[model samples]
Target: MAAANSVWISLLVSIIIVILFIQAVPTAHSQNDEDQLIWAKRVVSGNQVITNLQFYFHDVVGGRNPSAIRIAEAPQTKNSTTFFGSLMMIDDALTVGPDPASKPVGRARGMYGSAGQTDFGLIMALSYVFSDGIYDGSSFSMLSINPATETVREMAVVGGTGLFRMARGYAIARTYWLNAATGDAIVGYNVTILTYV
Candidate 1:
């Protein structure tokens, strides 16, 4: 009977500890959420710092092992001049140089859709996941329109994880090389981010 009483006490203590721990941890609330304006608590703390990064993205759209593949399309996509309503998923390589043989540092994984009816524009929603150097295991989310005809375009950096928690900024992307026949391209990216240091 005494041993059974001790076991119950231990279980009660553990339950109390778990409750306290849960209460001590704050819940996450999005800044854009309406409820956040009423009851949001400060959860992140660090010195605000800006960092600039430069890299290259290699997109292989053709060949046996392609990085970008068309996943869906509208009924009239083949007949449309802009390929509107087409969607593609990509796992493109991020490299240190414009050449595909250059050292790989990370990957860009996401989906892009041809949403423009009159122009060749893509709505990009991707994450730049890093795997090299100080940025290992870090990643940032990007969302913006990529005007394929433009020489340069700016992409929005909305949020991130790991070393770039709560990140926000922009990335300037420029086409470095392109194969009109194969639909393969190398794009250079210059990213500027405001993040916690």
Candidate 2:
């Protein structure tokens, strides 16, 4: 009877341990997800100006023209509040020339410099799917407009979070620098591009 009782007690202890483990796992996962969300929010809020400026350029350039542009993959989020976003510098030189469909002019005058203008800074914010949720933190990168290739390659964070499915949302802002001599003539334009997955 003593031996039987001891075995029963041991079995009970083992069952209790298993139960505790199962309960703890979910809590840990929840905490991790929460922490990620917080980090993302901080990043997004910190760069609000950059994000706003990019959108302003997007509006001015309109979808018809491909001014300075950067494209990035969307971020992944289990819920509505979690997402990723990015900003890119715009290169106007690539887009200023005559449309490829049009005949070449006798001499193409350089509207802007060979290299397009760079943004003061680009900022991005990840948007939540639901209207009520807060924006997720943003991922940042620098953009270089390559006239030869007619492409804007985002340098910083190129292979990082901005390129993966982990990014679910994005926003962009751009600032244009005008020449004082030209009386605030639009000398340089900055563009920010945002994407949401």
Scored by TM-score, the top model is 1
> Which residue window of length 10 is worst by lDDT in model 2?
50-59
TM-score of 2: 0.18
> Which regions of candidate 2 deviate over 4 angstroms?
1-133, 146-177, 181-197
Q: Put down candidate 2 lDDT per residue, 22-55, tens digits, no spaces.
A: 3333211232243232111111222221121111
lDDT of 1 by residue, 123-174 (tens): 9999999897778898999998999879999989999988778999898889
Candidate 2, residue 181: the lDDT equals: 37
Q: How many backbone collisions does model 1 have?
A: 0
Q: State the lDDT at 45 in candidate 2.
A: 21
Model 2 RMSD in Å is 21.8
C-alpha displacement of 50 in model 1, angstroms?
1.0
In order, what lDDT does every prediction score?
Answer: 0.79, 0.27
